[model samples]
Target: MSFGSFSLCKELQQSLIEQGYTKATAIQQQAIPLVLEQRDLIAIAQTGTGKTASFSLPMLQLLTKGTAATDNHIRALVLTPTRELAAQVGQAILSYSSLTNLSTTAVHGGVRIEPQIAKLQSGVDVLVATPGRLLDLYTQQALSFDKLEILVLDEADRMLDLGFVDDIRHIQKLLPIKRQNLMFSATFTNPIRLLAEDMLNSPATVEISPETSNLEAISQRVHPVDKNRKTELLIHLIKSNSWNQVLIFCRTKHGADNLVTNLEQVGIRGASIHANRTQHARTQVLGGFRDGSIKVLVATDLASRGIDLSRLSCVINLDLPFVAEDYVHRIGRTGRAGHKGLAISLFSDDESKQLKSIEKLIGRTFTQTLVPGFELAIKPIVDESDDDLYGNFEPDPTYLKQTQKRSKHTKSGSNRSRSKRR
Candidate 1:
């Protein structure tokens, strides 16, 4: 539906138009009005679903109509899991609220606290923060939640993954008991529900898609390569297919660096972003990637949740993700905002267990193709016995049969598919 139909504040409607947001996304269409009504909510949606705008657009108006905020006090709070996500959400807040006078600031770890202290000392109507850093600031008396009117937990599942449970609970306890609460998660796992029960007051729920689902616009394929030749295959595909820009996901920071080095050795422009990289370095890499100076951006799961490169069209899993949900997030970097994208995953026979788990979680099997020259050296051993490969993890017969049916469609040929990057 159109933004105008939402009865949004004129300034917000103007911001949406200036931002080229003519129509509200499903999440925005459903959640914005309820949020404006001050109802607690649980939003089940993925990154790049205009999730930031869904809440930011209406929250800006809510804060604008409410009492003016002052230094050291906050009217609204948005908690994210990572520094980059906090910055992205804070940037969204600023961009949407630009036409209004609402002050927005982001606070997170991996940066100095003193500057954030100064920002908070001057007071902010909206504060986007990482849970750990928020707790740190609260302990230092740099910020106060006494005036907090709305508390939003964006990507709440990621916070739990990052061990922010105690911080979330502590922050919950400090908020005004009557304040509004909103929680959004990629997957509403059991733990998230428990936390929601503690936070929400008969909240409304909106589910656009499950974390287990891949974007229909994303063409996903799996390349079966030996563990050692995976890098070579990646290099060959990049050169042969003329991939200008790609986001490569690695399981660890060291692996990300190693892949970048491998790409550089082959004369391909590559950069790496991970937890080990300094925030400055990470920012530089992201900036270059966005500007086309960096052809390949190798990163870990941290970037899976943080990076919001709408123009990125290709995502390569140099290795299978440790968690199935991470696979969804990695591919989510692309195929955003209704744009077509590609997701390539390279796995060896040793990674069969991971692949199986992922297939089960997503309830779909990927079309597995073998790159001609980089084909597997050793085939995975079949479970000859009746016991499950993963003990006690019984396979779903329907899913297993569906996987087998899909695998039969694999066509042996070149691995790379030519497509224009967004």
Candidate 2:
């Protein structure tokens, strides 16, 4: 349905028009009207589904009816899982509420409080923030929620995963209990359901897709390669496909760094984002990646939670996440806003457990194909006597040391791990 059909304020309508957003996505279609009516809501939607707009647009409309906030008071609140999502939601609110009298601000950690405190002094109509920073601001008496007409917990599942339950409860106690509450999550796990029960009253429920479900618009596949050959295969895929932009996922911060280092060997410039990087550095790397200057961006699960890339055509899983639901979030980076995209995973023998978990969650196995000549070939780890006992990759000192510990868990007599699912 077109955004024009919604009974949104003229300012919001104009903002959407200027941004060239003609039609609303499914989640928007279901949630916007209820939200504008001031009904509490629970939206289960994936990333890249235009979810940020689904709530922001209606929020602007609702806030128009509320009186302007004075110093330290806000009419609406948006709590996000990470600083990046908060900033993104803040930007969207600012853009949508531009012509209105509403003032929007986002605050997160990893930055100074003086500027944020100053902004709070001027007051904000809509405040978007992470749990930690929001609590910190409250402790400092920099913000007041007495006038809060709406409370939204965006990415609610992630917030729970980040162990913000106590903080969320604390924020809840601060807000007027009778106010409107909306909770949005990509999945409604038991934890999310419990949060919703305590958060939303009699509410409208919208489930565009389940947690296990993936976007049908994205093509999903897997490549079987040895753990060591993953870097070589990744370089080959990018160069051969002529992919100019790609988002690669690694499980750990160290892994992300190592992947970027390996990428440099093939003359590929890459940037890594995680907790270690400062706010300025993260912003610079994200800016470069968004502007097409950086071809590859490597990130861990927590760091990748905040990244939203436009026309991000490819996502490569150098390492699958341990959490099954994270796979949904990873591939969701691509195939955004109805645009088709590709998600490729480099499957290794050691990652079998994770791979199985992903398949079980999604309820289907992705296509597994072997790259000709790049197929996994296990060479024996030659001993001091040059005796090949356990076939591993090139029996080098480093290779032997790494695989020696794993040789005992030998499944069957063959050194080669099975390429297909059992």
lDDT score at residue 205, model 1, on the 0-100 scale: 78
TM-scores across all candidates? 0.90, 0.87
* Pairs of residues at least 3 apart in sequence or in different chains that clash in candidate 2: 379-392, 380-391
Report the lDDT tens digits of candidate 1 across residue range 1-422. Answer: 79898767888788878988887776787888888888888887766687888888778878888887786999999999998898888988898888988899998888788999998897899999988889899999998888889999999989998899999998888888878787888766668878888788878777664431237778889998888898999999898886668999999899889898889998998999998899878878888988999889999998998988766769999998767668878898888876788999998877776787777756687888988887667786756463465443334344344334433543311111122111
Worst 10 residues of 1 by lDDT: 413-422
Model 1 RMSD vs true structure? 8.3
Query: Candidate 2 residues 1-422, lDDT tens each?
Result: 89999988888888888877898877788888888888888887677777788888888888888678997898889999887788778988898888888899999988998899999996799999999999899999998888889999999988988899999988888888778888888766677767777777776777664321236778899998988889889999888897768999988889899989988988999999887888778879888998999999998886556887667879999998776668878998887766788999998877666776577556586667999878778632323353542223222232223233323443311111111111
Give per-model CA RMSD: 8.3, 11.5
In model 1, which runs have C-alpha deviations exceeding 4 angstroms?
210-214, 384-386, 390-422
